[model samples]
Target chain A: MNKTTNQDPVVVRNPTPSWRAILLCVLASMGSAAWAGTPLRVCYVDDRSGVAADTGIQSFNGFQIAVSEINDAGGINGQKVEVVSYDGKTDPQLTATFASRCAEDDGALAIVGGNPSAPAAAMIPVASEYEIPYLMLSAGTDNLTDMPAPFHFRVGPRNAQDAAAIAELIARQGFKRVALINNSLPFGTDSAHATEAALKTSGVPVVIQQTYDINATDLSPQIGRLRSANPDVIVVFPYAADGARVLRTLQQQGISLPRIVARSALLNTLRELAGDASDGVLVPNTVDMQRPDVKKFFDSYKTRFGEAQPTMYPVLGYDAAKMFLQAIADPAVQKALAADELADARVAIRDALIRNGNYQGLQGHAGATYQFGPDRHHGPPDQNWFVFVQVADKGKHLVAADLATFKPGS
Target chain B: MKSLNTARSMLAGPALILLVGALVPLLLTSGFHLRLVTIICIYTILCTGFNLLYGYAGQISMGQQGFFALGAYAFTLLMSAGNWSFWSALPAALLICAGVALLIGIPLLRLRSHYLAMATLCFGLVFAGIASRWIEFTGGTAGMMVPSVKFSGHIVSRTELYYAILLIMVLVLVMQNFIVSTHMGRALMSLRGDETAAQSLGVNVTAWKLRIFILSSVLAGLAGIASAVVNRQVNPSFSEFPILVSILTIAVVGGLGTRYGALLGACVVVIAPQGLAAFGESETIIYGVCLLLFLMFMPHGLSGLIPKLFGRIRRKAASPAPGVVKAGEIKP
Candidate 1:
């Protein structure tokens, strides 16, 4: 006789399956299968770790939340929008891996993100190879915008364009002498160049230009040297962490100029982190806290996540998802677009976005919608939205018109 | 008798596990998942190379990343900028990497322990600085274009790259296994256990150490080239040491002497972080905690743990057969 064991599959007397269990299994199977008419998959890659993780992750989270909402609201053309998210960790190799996976396996209809330029630069050729629509969410390099790739689109201002807007504003203010402090990274270099061009156009003279590594701890020496220039205004270009260091040093050094301004790094958590130092500083920002669209977004953000407001990053991320889904909604596009012909959809969506110019985004809501053509893939128009704001007990408030309205060197 | 039974049991578990791994890829259809697996294999090759030197030889070389950066950069820069064919560029890259290993080894190998580690670490930092600063040649910090790797006429895609890496890793593993099992392998192990004693035994210690050092460096260089070819780009950032690579030497923490322990250790270090990344970025904290746990409980590592667990089982099973020679046992 065979000895009974626990490992043995003992036959148990049972009744027929319950209708509920049967229904649940059926539902689970259906859930696992990709719905036949699903909308195209698009991958949004960003730095999910490292120093960039602090801000870059917000971009991805915003995009994911928006994409989920879009699907819940009934997807693009009744087809669900899916995104295969991957962490770039601010590294180019990791970016390439995620991008390739999306192109090869996910059958991605498009790809979006380039919050940091180094990885984004690596991704450009891959997007070109797969011919998929690649949306640039925050890479403000003039190089990208100056010569547009066939399927590239930018949702934010290029450095030169943003600087030009500042130039226009600064020209009106009639300031004639300015000093520039910039980071060593490409972003800072380009911003300085653009600011120089704008300043030259506005007839504001640049007194001194200083450069420092983003990780530099001592800015007192640089500030001491720059203060010797004795310019009317000082323009600083660095990320939030670096900028805070610079601001604190400047404050401690006891040097005060007519105006202190910065590039985009002065936004978001950087602004919050700067605390009192953030007050009385003018930075280039498209998001007018007063705009109706932006106010709604801010309210929803605070209510949903219990924050005061979303920053330019989250706003851009939400817009990137909106822009991608809008493309998926086009009739010619679908889940089954061949990989080779993927760029066609990208071009189509890019063109649609460019023409749908002046449509409000979360930040630059009232700004002219993005318009694209054969020669241009940069979003909206080349104009400045840099409103000079004062940080106070209430919150950051616009105290002056766009920086473009002031004379450079002010 | 107990030791013989314990050894049999240890071999059986790993043998089963490896057999499962070898078969799983064949069953899976998703090219994406296969591509991920291929990446793991490439990293395994890299970690294995590090293990040989760090684990078996008791050397700490942080410049393995520098060699990797060199291989990828040299290959990509040659192919894209120089317009060389993939075949020609690959050999050129290998030769250059081996040449670097030779030049670096002469001075670097003379140092011992932390000094050697620090020296190698400095090399990696300097290499990264050069890659970023030498904008004219290395694409500065932005990175250089990696021309598509072509075999025959077809430009290799992700799918093809995965297979290529797989074939290369398998070949490398087999060669490594063969070397570690030979007389030379025993000599290295002897040196690791006691250098003075090993030399006393006429093992030609210096020559063996130099050979393994160069061999390990070449493997790292080749792995870098493979990664560059697969990813289609290389930048200065590639040289930054992942905390994982350091823990990868934990392969020795377990198999510190055995090749299998090195592999098992590498998988735990590499794959665990990746799986945990899904939970949050705090996965790093978890990795640190796990490493601490392993150090505290299983000092000899997963490799050492295996034999002990099996030995206990064999002790229970063979109580009745104390005087009986096991079928697998040979008279020593």
Candidate 2:
């Protein structure tokens, strides 16, 4: 509770301090809440039951898989990995609360979660304040790793990378003009901004750009405006249901322009909602499904979780959990744990991550590896993190599209 | 005897609440617990404003969170962006909230009951949208950061902030007690009791409603500042719909018109989930059930039930023993 931040003018100038000493004694004791135990604890702070729940739920599923595999394989140096889960409900303030709660109340060694950027940003300061190691699953908003954060790390492609890839595809296809439409959520706005900037830089002029409310059921006006702009291609940033609505309106208006969704809002629900209208929409995907390990992991995820996310979500989750769990198994971390030094254990875990910096898992491009050090947190962005795919079979499948030669609806 | 009861409700109730609030830090040993209690104080302050507006003034606003967010942003921005001191930033924030409420309340106070609720809800949503969309000023979804308060060339600590928020909440309740004890308080009760009748009885209904609205909004702003100081951060989540609903729930479940109901409601809404393991992940469900149960069976709310129970006990105490009918028997 060392958070006194009020502005009392008379009190400030009165040259007297009230009740500062006793408060420190209490907080000092509270800071020692973390105690070493047989079962090591980590907290997963994610949106489990909100609009983007599938992403969080799938990531958590992958996180659980790693925990189970590790515990089954004789634990992290005989100490089983335990996970405490919190549903952030897509709110950053709520996420911050969960972060602090895990640090001070749950005594979590590290916190790993988030499928969105805002919540991820919220966790950073709290993690820094509490000195808890935090690993984010998939918050690819481009600017998250703009500065160096010692205890915070992320595993995902940047929105800027996605935008640049889409722009390259658009230029390669020789499209005349592009129209960009997005939902008004932060994710959408951010993606649209990035994509617009990339497009402008790539010599493709955006003919029209507009945003609709996230919950708007009727998008005919926006779709009609899209038709009026008469762009050769369209890039949309929409969540599942809204994506369906936009597609339906596109069909109704008979605007059969080539549509490219610039981000991860392309979900199974979109295809289900849009029916045949979602047939030819293209998406920039994170998972390169051709890799044997990636394919096997996706197959196991499908068999285990009832449905795979059909994206890079599970990989990101699995990779983060694997790295964190493995880092804790080091002899240095075990020494701190044996001594019941929770504070030292946290610092030890951070050091272990830096020592085991070349963490290779099923995330990023085929050859990409994770890194952590004093000056690096998010690591070097993998330029090849993206793989292009097109929606086919009434949204039942996403077939790989060779951007160099693929044409729309061919 | 009536004066005794009035004094109990006015002075004694708030005094006791303040006493308990003041002693929470020493009793609770954990920083997390202290943090939770500090949050509880913030929510209580927020519900106080809501209580005055909806409870006494006979207005229901689904947009209380809007005022809350406005206050938070104004305070944070003024302090962080304007480099204003905490003392000056607080008054500026309150003034901004009052100004906005006054401008809106003039046209808005004309609407009655649910219509007003709908309009205010829209206001809340619009403000939330602006907080999220207006990225440059509010920091958008990432939220704005607040600097810690310093005093006399020294850093003010967390304990001081906790006490500061607690003191503010108690003062708000005391002020509320003071407000309801005056002639204007009677007018407010009359307005809530029957608006048309109050107007006929020579009450300046519109003027009173506007004043209470401004007052309520200003209080909400104060709460936002307190919360920002505690978290040292303010995000769009401060103005989201779930928060607005929770505040309304606190008002309804604690009995709409009572003075101490805000504290009771804040405790239920804030402490209930964290206190018990079974309540985890089911916070929303518990709140729904609590609201529904209170609405259906105890229509008067928990605050109402307490007094009724007390009255029943008092009435039973005054009843004469069944076998002791000496006076009547002597007459016979």
Candidate 3:
């Protein structure tokens, strides 16, 4: 018997389908597992199935374009990016489940979603629980600010900050009498209340305050009611789509005031959807129109998305993704960060952003900043550097006035 | 003979289900999945309670989500306001829900199926409205957080919350079993099938309806509490009228008239999203399609499918025809 001593394959006629076969099988299994580990691993969950689903879809598309750019640039750390998007269905419970699933199973390092306040409120704890940063693209609630998490960061200004900026603008425009028209949503109600109160404190009295449903098409009655008040300035606090509709309604009603100031929330979909109606309407926004950074952003956005005009949400989505990238790319993070301590990289990124007063974002702005600490969960106080922009020449929205233009308590 | 054998197998179903469910978290090794399972368990408890009313009692109530939301909000308010321990706050939430159920049931139970459904649906919408508008009390639309429920001094993690939810669900199930096995269960079932007939047989239909309504509300409230703790946050949207939940109960998705159908139904509805999301936002399109398919083909839901499948397998295994297949064909 010419048996191989310890090899033991000598007795087997077929030799277990050859060693080459076994090696291939082992290698194949490992290769399959490694393949599972790749794919950009991005997540998009939004209230995309509910009343605001259409706008949510637009916001998600913007984030998709950002991810597309990353992949086109050879992806992060040499791995390709794959986005796993789900609908929160405008439901909070569903959003929480989706957020947790991404963090725990999909190994998603960051998230972008929660167009509505209700869903974002539910997901705040999930972000903390999973120890992954969530960049809320549309949610404007300061609720997340109350309970600080190193992992939670938002690209836009907080509601209170927006309210303060709008108040400052009202003071600058020299509009003493303003009418606040808000939607029935939390954002509208709070913005209306905050803006009204802040303006009141700043010695500007709101002539009329009215609320309407965002889902309603005929804002004619609401507009008519507000028109009766006939204030010099009208501050509309409806969300993107509805806000756009309301702006068109006001224009149709021939109700353009001497000064039209809108919350940044209104500008979310205003420029494109509202068309010429959005022109000449002043908006207090974090977008810095003067900087080369802002110009680069518009050019990049236009090249990638084929639309030069960027919605507030897509701008936010792009900012958040890049911010996440910057956080994870720190040198100390590369040297000392372990798999378990990966969240610290996000923390480092947030800290760097807070310290950076001049973050050259995709948009042409260096003033967009972030601030975080154990006591302060809110973004930078200096993030209040909102510029008053006018929709110039129908197609372009340009900076009408910078923060330096507005004197304090003007 | 087949029915008898099937009954024997069903007697073993709960144990098998529990065994599998208990092992899922360990097997998955993903903290996210564990949290998802915890959510599934929370819904299982709630929909199970609704099952007792709609499936067994023949009542259609849309207000279960209201109870759920109320429980969560109540628990949040109580725990945060008083800095009360979670152990204390949970029972308080249940009692508050039960009390609200009693108050609302007095007027709501007076209405019949569709009217009852509408009324309960209104309650859910109203609760959402209050949560949105009444910012002072309910944290308004921004929502308020319920501090992480603590045990000793350590904050509970999502994994720990999952186990806590599982234990509560098991307890609710055990209690459900105890109730269903007794006279009250038979009486409630009779009322569901025919309140007039039950009344003719000397059953206090109204009283029984009120009792079941209140009991169901209490359980739903408990589920809400479990959900809030597990999710580590409370918002009005947690219970923004679970229309699908109500539909699942009476639709025979789980076996109609079978209490355990609630569990199967919840599993189907809840697990579908995680699996379907791979197809994208059109996952909702899938949900609608599945609803259509279930409505047309499997009217009795998973409950009907389960029994028929098991019976077929047992019949084939014990007495196989020439062309018949072997055992394990029927799933439990």
DockQ for all models? 0.21, 0.15, 0.32
Candidate of highest lDDT: 2
Which digits, one per residue and each the tens of the lDDT, describe model 1 over residues A138-245?
A: 766555554536666777666676677666655667667788888876567667778898888778889999988889989888999988988777788788788877
lDDT of each candidate versus the true structure: 0.66, 0.77, 0.68
For candidate 3, lDDT tens digit of each residue in B26-64?
A: 555456555556766787788778878887788888878
lDDT of 2 by residue, A1-410 (tens): 22222231100011111122123445334343545553688888888766667788888877877777787777767666767777777866567766777887778899999887777778887777778899887777555655556688777676767778888888879886888999998778878888889888888899999899989989988888888897888888888888888888898888887888755545677778888888778888777777788888888777777766457778777888888988788888888888898888888888888788778788656886776666677753556567777788887788776555445433
Candidate 1: how large is its RMSD? Answer: 8.9
TM-score per model over all chains: 0.78, 0.90, 0.82
Give the interface RMSD values of the models in order. 12.7, 11.1, 13.0
- Native contact fraction of candidate 1? 0.15
Question: Which model is ahead, 2 or 3, in terms of TM-score?
Answer: 2
Query: In model 2, what lDDT does residue A166 have?
Result: 88
Output the better candidate (1/3) by lDDT. Answer: 3
Cα deviation at B203, candidate 2, in Å, is 2.2
Ranking by DockQ: 3, 1, 2
Compose the digit string of candidate 3's lDDT tens values, residues A162-248. Answer: 788888777866776788888887778888888887897899888888899879988998889888986777888877778778878
Residues B100-150 of candidate 2 have per-residue lDDT tens digits of 999999999999999999999899889988987787778777677778788
